[model samples]
Target: MDERFTIRAMKKEDIEEVYEIEKMSFTAPWSKESLYYELEQNLFAKYLVVEYEGSVIGYCGLWVIMDDAQITNIAVHPDFRGRKIGEALLRFSMQLCKEMSAKRLSLEVRVSNHIAQSLYRKLGFETGGIRKNYYTDNYEDAKVMWVNLG
Candidate 1:
């Protein structure tokens, strides 16, 4: 956290950098075209990026539908891992969702991703349920988690 970073909504010009981080962080990353569509076409989408020294280092995206928000992705560049950038990005995004009038936020994490699950729990997210075979890449079960902003 010693490094200074600014979190802001993702812009069209920031797509490439964000996509690169996405690729580095996910076993099954979203395509650049899909990311572009989320920003340009998905009305419910709210994407944010963390910038350090004028470069994108982390990003998170969510879809707020009515009073509920569902996180689609949260990731930090591989070089920036273990710095709590992911936590900061998710916290900032949750605040943004609250400002947008979202009463709750939720996300799905791989059952084996204990690190992410621990972080979510630290942020007050609780295990809600499980989605069997949620990750198409490996037929991995996903642990559903939720937090009420109120």
Candidate 2:
């Protein structure tokens, strides 16, 4: 398979596909209604989707406020995981934040998600702290990670 992945700003119509990937990738997925709200109502949010052959295969959610930015969520379809799509999405998101003049970018990962944590560290993120019981589904502590964009 020729994996020609393209990343672009997500549109309202991409919600259903994005929601599917979201549900498959996370233990507690965001509701489609919440995605609608993110696209239609959230002022601090920006979303980007990765398209492969006209299908939405992955997505990233970003929230920028002042000079700080947060990765609200990010995921790639299981069928597309080994291609480093998630890393690409994170790189793109970091560039977007830099373009927006954000001095720092941060996100939380489940402590058990070492693959993701490895990717974050490769992108220069460092562990900042731990959030207790961050994942409601399993009550797993979240490892807070951050990187300096400046």
Candidate 3:
């Protein structure tokens, strides 16, 4: 397979492209203002962008607090789906957390996102709990997943 994608630290300039994928991937996408806030003001936030031929195709965000890390969000462009781009991005995030001395990582996924859940499981994440009505858009439940990196 062609792993032509390049992953790098996200920048303020990447927001427009990231927002495009965000809207395409989520029912209720994060606002540009919110993304900007995270990139500029959120001290705990760290984001990575996946680029293909110089275009931002995927991205993931993580927050390392003390010995724990939390995945904020991850998404890929629809055109780039099924190419393992999301998986690559996630694996990269896991490494970043480890480098930051995080002992574990966790994230919440929509209960209906079986594909994502499967990927999480393949990466050694275990279902820890469920957050009821986690999605404000449709009141969908979210499954919380965790992995011990320690």
Candidate 4:
């Protein structure tokens, strides 16, 4: 939890490290192709990586469309969890969303992920709705959350 840890826009070279963290952090993680598509094709997508001491420990992606920003994904390495890295990443993403003139930010979290729910709530996000059987790997429901920025 060093205060010197930095977050910056993700580079193509950082995808491997990001991918590793994605795999480690989620049970049904995004495929490499899906991530590459976001990096190479999504024009409105902004991806970021968190680095501490030159090592990538976490990543987040946002897709901005009009006045809304959709959080595509966020993950932190297991070893780096509980150190506030996720909170830092979320705050950074919120700032980026505001800079983009987004009126709101939205994301979906597994309903069972209480830890993430609490973190998002602390950041001013509220549960908006639920998507039934949203997670493909295990058919878990997703709790859609949103934060009003305006």
Query: What's the CA error at residue 87 for candidate 1, in Å?
Result: 1.3
* 66-150 per-residue lDDT for model 1 (tens digits): 9999999998998889988888888888899999999999999999999999999999999999999999789999999999998
TM-score, structure 1 vs. true: 0.97
The C-alpha lDDT values of all candidates are: 0.93, 0.94, 0.94, 0.93
TM-score-wise, the better of 2 and 3 is: 3
> Model 2 reaches what TM-score against the true structure?
0.97
Task: Highest TM-score: give the candidate number.
Answer: 3
Give TM-scores for every candidate, taking all chains together and pairing residue i with residue i.
0.97, 0.97, 0.97, 0.97
RMSD (CA, Å), each prediction: 1.0, 1.4, 1.0, 1.0
Model 3 misplaced stretches (Cα beyond 4 Å): 1-3
- Residues 77-145, candidate 3, lDDT per residue (tens digit)? 999899888898899999999999999999999999999999999999999999999999999999999
Q: What is the C-alpha lDDT profile of model 2 across 1-150, one tens digit per residue?
A: 245889999999999999999889998999999999998899999999999999999999999999999999999999999888888899999999999999999999999999999999999999999999999999999999999998
Cα RMSD for candidate 3? 1.0
lDDT of prediction 3: 0.94
- The count of backbone overlaps in candidate 4 is 0
Higher-lDDT candidate of 1 and 2 = 2
